[model samples]
Target chain A: MFDTVNLEDARRVIAAAEKKAAAIGQPMNIAVADAGGNLVAHVRMDGAWLGSIDISIKKAYTSRAFDIATKDLATHSQSGNQFFGIHASNNGKIMIFAGGIPLKRDGRVVGAIGVSGGSGEQDHAVAEAGAAAL
Target chain B: MFDTVNLEDARRVIAAAEKKAAAIGQPMNIAVADAGGNLVAHVRMDGAWLGSIDISIKKAYTSRAFDIATKDLATHSQSGNQFFGIHASNNGKIMIFAGGIPLKRDGRVVGAIGVSGGSGEQDHAVAEAGAAAL
Candidate 1:
């Protein structure tokens, strides 16, 4: 059976992401999803952008559902690109942008973390911190 | 200006709900929403049903959007009732069932709490515990 993230793993990832957000002086909404792209946990930091809550959760689903970082997906999802309009799929749950990273174990994707409430670079950085924790 | 639930408040509510769920020996997915129907936080307890995640969040939104317990809403939303088919509205966000309750402060609804993963009665009980904390 494939290993998947659990509540403890999700909390660890979120804690790391929160640290990175604090280091950068940016509050964020962070979400973790298991191998099935189902959310395990989520948090919207105090004063974080309210709109990012859904985006963070959807981003984690997008990453684990596709096993690719959302930053890479954004490239192909641009206009005239291979994945153009793909965001319209999954009932608008696909988020093609930076900030989502798949967590790996034994070189296999086990889960994903998504961060929002900052620029693409900052979000990606925070997600990287979270993924590293896993 | 009307008060709205924040991340801190959301955490407190979730903690109370979690305690109640533990006492009942039922893990659950819990969600809290701000007055604007925006999600503040969510958590899926270990071993909770995956499908309950979305249901919990939507239940919170539905509760805040209508300022009524979903148990009561279900009564009015049944076939041939005044609100029959109301679930078809809100882009599938409305959950016409138990477990969603408005969070009120000084006689005004400030937010809502939702719980899923158990029977309707259990879910409603957990939500009530969360709302009581807020």
Candidate 2:
């Protein structure tokens, strides 16, 4: 049976990402989604815009739903056939772009983490930190 | 000088609301917005549809921005001049209906709380629990 992602693991990932962001002096919003595309945890830093929360969750949802990193989806959407429409089809819940990465354990994807509020590159960096912590 | 609402206060309100919902066995999504209409905290219970998050936040935004309970706006929009358009003008960030109430301290509005993921009456009841906790 596939077990649900542990909430403590998700919090550790977020803490690691926050530490990295703090080191860079950037505030961000982070969201974690379980393998079932259900939200596990979310945090929005004190200066981060409220919109970042939605964007971060969308990115995480896209990563978990597609079972791939959001960065790769951004590249594919630009070249694939009517791929961008997939986001609209999902009731605008999926965001195909950087800043979201699937979490893996023993080569199996368990969940996804997304970070937003900074530039794409910065957001990607923060997401990577979260993934690395896992 | 006005006192800024502390995060602990918000958490207490949310806890009370959650306890009430637990007693009723209804899952919910709740959002709290600060004096500046910015999200201070948000919680999504398991089994609550993801869409509830957006609806809750929009209700809180509408309550805070309009300086009235969201339930009142629903009634006014049906009989008043171009009132429903106000929600559209706000970039779809406001929802006019029940389930939201502004937080008051010393007779001044300090913030707002919104609840969703159940019947309108249930949502309103949960929000009232949050407000009463304050």
Candidate 3:
């Protein structure tokens, strides 16, 4: 009843994210969730920060929930914006920072990828790589 | 990152659940999450109940969150019990019912498995099969 990322694509996304993290010399926690915000894939690098594990998963959930990259959401979540309190609304699972990107299939979002354990720019870059794997 | 359930193990858990589900002639939605309550893997078998997708994931999260099986938690969630109304907490993600089981290694909880789209007893049995794959 719903368009979702298949298992094969989910693993491909994770592999791309892992490659980017290694290229950047930063370990990362990566997560992928279907359009329904259901987890499809996950990975924690050998040296990634443990705390970033949940953040990565939550970022993917938030991206799939909103159909937008978290960096864009970060702008709208700033003070006095339409979604100002959005992060605090979803049981503190909304990730307004960078590192979350929705995956598109024929111009429609089918899933999202999230990466953490680095600067916002680095995280976003890795997430972008994951999305590019589509 | 800390030692967590790898992606391979997460897939193995799902396959085990699928095998049990098939043997029983019932489809299922299975979920696996690491000890931190972060999602690791999820699969919704053909003809499975859509509603059970979220339930499966939440059951896994609840199991990992408390390090106890949902079957055991159900007892504590009974009326007048210590954890009554526990389902209303954590954004209503708690599944104080059967089908959730924690995955252990060296006697420490490392992750959890959950199965839905079946009776509580059936779900519990499927979840146990998934956990045994570890």
TM-score of 2: 0.75
A1-134 per-residue lDDT for model 3 (tens digits): 66888656887898899999999999898888887787665677766887897899899999999999999999999999988989887788899999999999989999999899999999999999999998
Of 1 and 3, the candidate ahead on DockQ is 1
Error of 2 at B106 (Å): 4.3
Q: Which candidate is the best by DockQ?
A: 1
Candidate achieving the largest lDDT: 1
- Candidate 3: tens digits of C-alpha lDDT, residues B1-134: 55578667888888888899999999888888886777666767766776887799899999999999999999999999999999999988899999999999888999999888999999999999999998
Per TM-score, the best of the predicted structures is 1
Sliding window of 10 residues with minimal summed lDDT for model 3 chain B = B38-47
lDDT of 1 by residue, B53-119 (tens): 9999999999999999999999999998999999999999999999999999899999999899999
Model 3 per-residue lDDT at A106 = 89
lDDT of 1 at A113: 97
Q: What digit string (tens of lDDT, one per residue) describes model 2 on residues A5-112? A: 665677788889888888888889888888888776677776776688789988888898998888888876865555756667588888877999999888888989
Ranking by TM-score: 1, 2, 3
Clashes of 1: 0
Per-candidate clash tally = 0, 0, 1
Docking quality of model 3: it rates as: acceptable
Which ranges in model 3 have alpha carbons more than 4 Å from their true place?
A1-3, A23-25, A36-47, A64-66, A76-93, B1-8, B22-27, B33-54, B64-67, B80-93, B106-109
